[model samples]
Target: MDQYAQLLAALTEAGALGEEWRGAFERAPRSAFVPDGIWVEDSDAPSGYRLLSKAVDPVGWWAEVDSGRQVVTQLDDGRTDGPGVATSSGSMPSLVASMLRHLDATDGSTVLDIGTGTGWTAALLCRRLGDGAVTTVEVDPAVAAAAGVRLAELGLEPHRVVGDGLLGHPAGGPYDRIHSTAAVQRVPLPWIEQTRPGGVIVTPWGTPYANAGLLRLEVGERGRQSHGRFVGDVSFMWMRAQRPHAVTAPDRPPDHRGPSPLDPDLAEENVHAAFAIGLRVPGVRTLHTWQAADPSGTHRFRLSDDAGSWASVRFHDWDGADAVHQSGPRRLWDEVVAARRAWLEDGRPELTRFGLTVTATGDQHLWLDDPGNALS
Candidate 1:
């Protein structure tokens, strides 16, 4: 079997691809959407990625395209040459399939596809729902142009626009579904407005602390409100405007030094703990660092609000309690500990148990179990 067929078979066996999307997947092969040169993770490389060109190494390039892995298509938004960081990528096939399934689109359903990275998703939507029913928006002009070319080559012409996906394409109003390829800290109000009542919005939503959760929200009457639970865990590139600020340690000495009530490792090890803590504590980002040269195997868990408050917990190999340090007005570690405590008191509910409600006034209320029980 060809690589694409094998990929489809594998996805079918893994239950990632259902019969509804099998035809679309076959029609829009990933190879056609992937760029000629793609970046792969490299530990020894300065930027942690090494580019593999289709011309130079077809074998390696094809392998990456066929594999169920995200392929970085652009670095630094195509601004710089070396020591690159991925600004855009073709998402993993399984993840794409899963997100599409959550979309719950059907024949005659109008879809607004946000973040047209490679246009593969738009093509699939067009194949399933027809070209006129799908509208795709991308913020980057170059990216959009390239993706448009690919879509046109495949004779899949969805309404393509270049604009901030956060605002969404208002011209295509009252869509049956709004699907976003990018992750967001805040669901854009415009999206809710553009979606018709009872419409579904599927996107990767998360906080700065734990940026990974697939959220599916259903719009209410008059498109004034939407409510949904986190259906699964998914990590996607953040919408440009919603990307978190870089976390850095404060220059001055810590204002308070004490022992931590909870093991700092738990927050990093358990995704549910991290997600719950993130929901409770807003604007906090986490960084886990280990001293590779240190023979003692000591590591540090750092937290920062990026508003002058920062905290750190040092974990040592010895059995003594980990030392916690905090500086600035907010005791970041204390807040995290409190959040963790609340999560535990609530029986450590899994991330899926958490849900979000958004009002027309743009208030986002996160809750546990039901909308009446608000957490934030």
Candidate 2:
């Protein structure tokens, strides 16, 4: 408890968290959700796995959770002798704070929490929304059962179900808010249909290649229609159904440097745009990197097609991930060029300038601030 107090204090100072939510943080000690074995990200530590023994440095463990990165508590389907791959975990406390803020959870509202890993977030929701008003779903039976016990320890008993979150819990219908701790590229139609009109559904939406943003959507009169814009950049693992068997090699590597100073702007790849491109260009992989040989003034990129053919590009620019390059036969670079051209033609509007508008008829529209500018 003392260890988490320190963590809470740090969060409170940062203004990333609130004193009001301190009870939720105290009520759910992160140590409760972490397994006995895990890994530490320090340099050159052979046994990456961490243990929960009083003799061990418990303070250090709590500190790691303070960083906003996901911690792997369980790996490789929850079976590992030592340092097994962390397949599941209690997400970082700061990340949880970000999600909760994005949710804007009001008091006494019925909320459905998907991906109840470690049950830490569920308890937090229970604190904000009250018990039974929060229902969480986990795909793994073990995860769901374990979280159920931890919630009980906190004197909370939110409904914890083990099943596919893709098919949201219909039994807990007409929820005021739906929050998914995990990321989903596709906003399942069922979620839109389940929530009450004007209810909010927040999830990290991305494509198989790169879609990264906390998507905030609002359901309307028609249970099936939703419209919203992305807020802030975020990353998450692909849903089981949204993952790729293997990403194709780049047709040719890309040049991190752009054609001109202007290209540098687009070099910062929009995760949503990246994902949308992946869906349109099915089976194309895009990668950007710097020239390791001479780090000073060289850039490279690679994009490959599913057929195993790849393309490479070279240019001079300083943006690492956002750098652009041209490669391969398919001219994936040209595709990026085309999108930018279209965006510019539309008055160089930023993506947020046009938010997503979903309709009950399954019609998805990207609305620009100037409604007249939308290409349709």
Candidate 3:
């Protein structure tokens, strides 16, 4: 079988691609949306990825497009000419399908798609909901224009505009459904404002502690507040405006305190552990690095906040003591331990058990099982 057919068959069998969206997948070929020149990540490479070009190798280009892997179309918001780091691209087919499935948009539903990217998601929505029913907003002008051209070539034209997705395209709404292709630290107020009462908003929501999940919120009748549970785990690039402000790593002075009584490896890399920690310790980001000082290359997790506060936990030996150091007003490690203790008390709840509530005034409250019992 051909690559396209094989992909369709595999997705259908695996249940990632449902019949509801199969028509869009068939009508709008993925190859049509991909750029001729793109970057493909290589795990072993120091630079992390090598650029692929249709001009250089057509066969290899088609292979990667059909391989169902994310092709980086632009880097550093199109400022970096080469493959420095991926800023945006056409998302993998399976993940796109999965998110669409969860979105549950249907005929007659007016939709607003955030972060147009390659415009594939908007095209898919347009195919399903019709042209006038879909409106897509992209932040990068160059990316939006390129996507608009491709979409027009396919006879698909949804309201493709260039603007900050965080502000949302208010002219499009109050839409019946709002879907964002990017991840957010917090749900924006405009989205809630533009969505009709009882409408749904779907996007990948992340925490500073190091976990992200799909958030599906239903705007209340008043349209000021929305509450919903986390559907599942999802990883997406952050919205440009909401992206964390870069802060310098805090120094580990020689006069730092003793080793932590807690084992860093105990809950170091676990997703649920990170999620739990994020609820209690807000406004902190983690970066895991492998120190060469330890031959085993055990990870050293660094915690930092926008306030220049930072801490590091080096797991050199799994069976022995791990080094812990902090130089901040807020004791981040202590917060992590306390959060973990709370998680243990709550029977070690997974991310699925947690939910979020966004007030009309825009305060997000993280809850476990019951919305009334919100975490600070």
Candidate 4:
């Protein structure tokens, strides 16, 4: 069997590709959406990614396209010279299929697809829902134009839009289903507003602690609020606008702070603990830098946000005390420790046990087990 056939067969066998979307997947091949010159993320390389071209290596390129891996089509928002941060790509087939399966859009239902990357998702939706039933919006103009061309070539015409994905395309309004291909910090108010009452909105939800969780919300009759549990773990690129603004730690003074109450090793070993920590600590991004030269296996966990707040915790080992440094209005490292303590006190809840409630006014209340008990 060909690569596409093999992938489809595998996905079907794995139950990732539902029967509802099986014919659409076969009819609209993923290859049509992927560009010739694409980049794949490789940690082995110093630059983090290596470019692959259909012209240079058709066999390899074809293999990647048909494979389940994500194919990066753009880097650094189209500014980088080589192998920079991946800005966009054709998402993994299994992930796409699984999300679509979760979407569970029925016939005659009008759907809105956010982040039309490669337009593959839109194409599949068009094949399933028919022309004019699907509307897709992309943030980047160049990406939108490229996807439009590909969709046109495939004879699929979904209302292609070029604008912020967070702000759902209201022109396509009152959609029965709203699906975002990108990850978001919170459920956008515009999505809830644009979705019809009782409609479904599915998106990859990320917290400050970690880039994970697939949120499946059912729009209420009023369309002003929605609540849903995280269906599964998902890691997708942030919505372009929701992406973190440029923030870096400035030079710190030669002052020593108290040791962090939280254990870095505990957070590192437990994904759920880390995720819970992130949920409690809002607007901060965490990064850990390992010390290669240090014989004691030391590492520094840096926390910073767009608000000019920054903190760093350096630890030589899990058992010993770690040095903490802060040089901002907000004591981020302290906040993380407090949150971690709270999480531990709460018995270290799993990601599935958590839920989110979004108001039309943009208030996102993260709750534990029940919406009534909001996490503070």
* Model 1 weakest lDDT span, ten residues long: 314-323
Winning model by TM-score: 1
Clashes in candidate 3: how many? 1
**Estimated TM-score for each candidate:** 0.96, 0.76, 0.92, 0.93
lDDT tens readout by residue for model 4, 132-250: 89999998999999999999998999998899888888877999999999999978888888888888899999876688888888887673668888888788988987886544545
lDDT (0 to 1) per candidate: 0.90, 0.67, 0.82, 0.84
Weakest ten-residue segment in model 3 by summed lDDT:
314-323
Which candidate should be chosen as best, given lDDT against the real structure? Answer: 1
Q: For model 4, what is the alpha-carbon lDDT of residue 323?
A: 76
Clashing pairs in 3: 224-360
Residue 63, candidate 1: C-alpha displacement in angstroms: 0.7
Model 2 residue runs over 4 Å out of place are 1-15, 18-20, 42-59, 66-69, 76-86, 250-266, 269-284, 288-300, 304-310, 315-330, 340-354, 361-363, 367-376
Residues 91-133 of candidate 2 have per-residue lDDT tens digits of 7777677778777777778898988888888888888778879
Candidate 3 residue-wise lDDT, 154-236, digit = tens: 99989878998999888778899999999899999889999889889999888767547888888887745688888877778
Better of 2 and 3 by lDDT: 3
